[model samples]
Target chain A: MSESLVSRIKPVLGLDNKWWWDQAAEGVLAIQRCQGCQSLRHPPRPMCDQCQSQEWDFISASGKGTVCSFTVLHHPKFPGYDYPLIIVLVELAEGTRITSQLTGCEPDEVDFDMPVEMVMQRDADGFQLPYFRPSQ
Target chain B: MTINVSGEAAIAGVANTEFSKNSGVSELELASVAVRDAIADAGLKPSDVDGMTTFTLDNTDEIEIARAVGIGDLTFYSRVPHGGGAATGLVHQAVMAVATGMAEVVVCYRALNGRSGHRYSSGVAGPLLTSDAIHWGWYTPYGLMTPASWVAMYTQRYMHLAENVQDAMFEIAHVQRQYAAKNPAAFFYQRPFDRADYDASRPIVSPFKMLDCCMETDGGSAVVVTTAERAKDLKHPAVIVKGVAQAAAADMESMTSFYRPEIARIPSMDIAAKMAYEQSGLCADDIDAAVIYDAFTPIVLWQLESWGFCDLLEAPKFVLDGALRSDGRLPTNTHGGQLSEAYIHGVNGVVEATRLVRGQSVNQPAKEVNNVLVTSGVGVPTGGALLGRSD
Candidate 1:
């Protein structure tokens, strides 16, 4: 199937979210950093909630974080994902959190506060998404 | 300062349509049935209902139900959002309306084919752009799509903090199922499970076995609200709306609120609980029965902690101590809760609260049940209420 017509769900491409996706596709995990307050945010927003600044810039994070929380989904399988899929809330070193899939480990192997590093994982259609893995 | 409307409005009637996995009828019909029954339970004609309210998530609107039920000339109408969290807030709106004379008789109802139609457990299929959808867009593609997955994120963190997370979760399921065994209306009706069964159930999301999840039931529940004085002339003894509150913290998100500093704490619940106590002038110790929302078992413990019935880290010990039994410290969900009973959102919980207050609960407590605390959905903007007997 063509990348654009793979029948796999993809993030809604919009003015606020397109930049992050474009950056992630290039193998860099970028987050919105507010120009007014330097506050970093994930799942990009139109305005910096803290400083109310519509002005922002993207910063490529260090790709390192700790698992603040996680869940292993085992039922009602969806397309483009495996069963017992590990989803994690990673608190980035820069002090913001993002929800992403965690690969390279068993469901029981992931623990809270475990150090992880972000890596680019793509959907069947070739859209890259940020996923995390345990750091040695 | 929050205006305390305690004892101003009373729940004169509470009724529900048959509980089922599939009602085989439209949500509108279910709403009409539940509303008509609730009004009759209050010993009032449909014409007496001049106002109506319900949750925004409910497919059946007040006007539609009003039209079908023959309720005329609504002086007040409103809808509270936040999914099941608005269950008790429906009472809050109705009470506020009746207390201020905006409406004399108000009916609160929620109807949906949650199972047969839009199953919440079945994750959203989307690329939608509603504000809520925007939040889901962030993680749904990453396989964090369903409500179970979102709650599991924090529940896993909760497990790390608690001494016996798995055992505690299983015990909650076991206790509620035991209650369900006695209540014929429960989805699990006579199918009680042991701890072994809970442990062996299929895992939907980590830290959440199949037993921990509430059945997505298709049904409707409705309650009637009126001035406390008028309730004295009603069919059943009045269940006073002592206090009602809806609260959300600064960082509160719909369901995935992991971005906050403390993902384990349900701040919205704590806020609502605090307001319930303050407005009602009653503490956790005064509550005789509680109908804590149990869409997921872990949430029951989360709410017990948030409501200050026990310390945040003491819920497991609290549960193991038999605190949820009919003769225990806080006999909870005497009607089996959403975990075992029908998941009519949390409105069924509200109805159970009225039953306990009226001494009509199937699993009535050993002691006199006076004040019953009914909490709505957690993991989102939540609401809480304190219902009590007038004397």
Candidate 2:
């Protein structure tokens, strides 16, 4: 209600997950892989769950994913944001899932197992965020 | 060896301030009133309380509340994390404290002017502390702000997997609201069920209508816990703590834990239920009534399966079949739940559980309720409890 759907709000970054924002800033969707367990995790943590290993690395994702789930949020709208926001949980081709927004698509356009592709977009504040659109 | 807390401790008394959209009071005032009333309900003086437990999110302080209630010495105190999921965990904490002889009388309370004060419906708007923002940092920037959105992601995945679920979401709302319609304490009291209303309701999050969400109200709820031996000498019938457990499963995030193998399943609920049932020595069949968390409608479905009330992914039909009705197998949240009743988080559910076990519920079911299962919220580190009736 205050302004356009795009707000200048940015994610608060810390020492551990700053690298994730760095990847997005460069227009690359990246995921964290546990160097010890050979498995992947996200949001950039220090330890691994499978083997309790504190070792990890970042790998560039394929930018391909499926619509694992989604929602059309309307009420309690935020400043500089439109109503009925389309938020999606995408299961990346790398077997891990990530949370992002959907652009260039309608609400009814979303479906279960819908295929999507990740795209990095910059906000007015120059903060890069990962988003998904219908994969061509 | 660990002690079996079942029957070791009991809830001697329970009390709740009026559920309202605006309490016109401070959270500390709410806490003070609820705790003091609960102590009096137990036929005990405020001086008898030596221990206290509450949610870490609660604004009231232990020392402040102790001072407000005019208590003597403070031996045991704890603050459970995970928002609404800390409901039953409070009882678990108090039971442990009293059972271990660390404290004589422990009072657990959750006080919030959620409507007039900090409303959860707005979601996490601005940044708080760095340490507390772990979960939000991952999802907040991407239009995932509200608790409804966090849950919507899971509900989407779950509905996709279940496939058979359609009207169950609305029906879950219907049944719970049906229960609320009968209870004067509920916000939706006397509001009859109308499927058309549910269908016409505006969508807040996909697969979740406005009715699918829990009401946000300002109120306080509290319970007094003591050793079963001492509780028997007090006021009302003692509701013994049979089994209680808390859990945070593998790959646990706060709520937006979509990175797991499948976002559809709630491992937290499964783990908590397994542990609680093991502690209570009761299976799904043993539970006569339930107060499962209903922060959202799909959560009830997810929990029904995770808690072993039905087969995996079969809660849709199970719930649609009126399994939650009083005449059905399990009369759940007969006090209307958070959806219809005031959202005092989950403590109100436990109060309703105590009523059922005591055979004093207004919407009392036909069956003999020997045991009641009460759960806190899922999607975060959560907990559950099984309460039993005494002769």
Candidate 3:
């Protein structure tokens, strides 16, 4: 997992979101949860929509999920990523979704509701990020 | 208490600079010219315009547009965010201004050098400076940054369950182009393509072909809104703002509302449709024509279904059955659309809806168009409005 297959873009980390990337780097997939209302949120937010609680914590999710949806991009030919890139939305077993690239599969080989598991990879800048691979 | 300002304000004027690849001028100049023309089209002096609304994405400020158009002061001025989704929101802002006696004549305008300057499709490459960048950060690392890619997340899921969507997507583009063939202001005017051209077009993002994407043209479009009573004395027939709703659904991310329970549905548009129907007291059956935002072909199907013009997974079938043709049940995008007309960020759509209600569209439907539904961007916080004649 140290040697990179291809360099990737680094995320613009923020106070609340930085924690998720930090957790992914430590071999753990973390999801945010509101302490007061016990509600879970993705892409991490400061407050809870259910109870207006600014207080929250995280849950270590099982890295197993299913690809709910995906896209194969060809144009804009962005640097650091291969063409016909397949990015997927994986619905985690704990009932929340996470966005990441689907690795180890061709764009044509991917299908809806496919089973996938998370993998940690380091970009060119040594920034660790999460990716999804098809379940064996 | 709900603000039922429905039927109180009307759109009295609609104008647009020609759609082209290069305007050879600044966006500020385009806004001034379009605004000036819209004021004249409303048959009102510049001094009479006291309010203004434009997209936050627009380069020109209201004071700058006001100064350039020779207007003195403004009692109410605002900008709606969310890019193209702000089209009908501009109308909402204008109607509210006139409704509360804040401003007499409010102009909603959008001008951009999308082709000649910064093409929007290219902005997704990297490093979006907006505050929303925080939300996009999670996706960009995986190269899921562009609007097409973001929308594909939903479209891929949609096509998975639907039938004949590929054919329907092409037919929507072709049908809009058919309407564009008759519009001199359209980018594709005098140029109509057949099924062969569609098959030949390359797919940019798997489901979306090159021809399916909207035109990135350099142009400007503006509309004038005023009180229903004052609009009656204008040069042209007044198209009353019978219903307008701006909806920012929960858990919405700019274009990447992928975390929603139903990945294929546009909750914002559904919310806007419900609010609009409640405000106007008009059902989908009352709509005679429409200008559904065509940023991409799939968007038309989404809006049509969201606005209740058709059922879920039924939009493609609706298009395949010729529901959008001039002689079809509901004539749509008679001035073309963002696809064939121009991408003024859906503001041109509001202008065209005004034309349909005023009975002045170039390719007017054979059936009389009174309640014309106009919508802004989807997959984001969006808006929609129903326009019809006060008479």
Q: Alpha-carbon error at B83 in model 1, in Å?
A: 0.6
Pairs clashing in candidate 1?
Answer: none
| Candidate 1 residue spans exceeding 4 A from truth | A1-136, B127-129
Candidate 3 chain B: worst-modelled 10 consecutive residues by lDDT: B64-73
> Per-residue lDDT for B1-391 in model 1, tens only?
5556888999998898898887876677788778888988999988898989999888766776665566778999999998988989899899999989999999999988888888888877654546767777789778888888888999999888887877888878888888989998788889988877777899899978899898888989999999999999999999999889998888777898889987877889999999889888899999888999988888888899988989987898898888998888999988888888889989999999999999998898879889999999988788899999997
Instruction: Return the TM-score for candidate 3, rounded to 2 decimals.
Output: 0.74
**Candidate models: Cα lDDT each:** 0.86, 0.85, 0.86
Q: Write the per-residue lDDT of candidate 3 for residues B282-369, one digit (tens) a residue.
A: 9999999999998888888888888888899999999888999999888999898999999999999999999998888999887878
* Candidate 2 lDDT over residue span B100-199, tens digit each: 9999899999999999888889888765665868768777778788999899999888888895565888877888898999998888899976889998
Query: Across all candidates, what is each one's fraction of true contacts kept?
Result: 0.00, 0.00, 0.00
Clashing pairs in 2: none
Winner on lDDT between 1 and 2 is 1
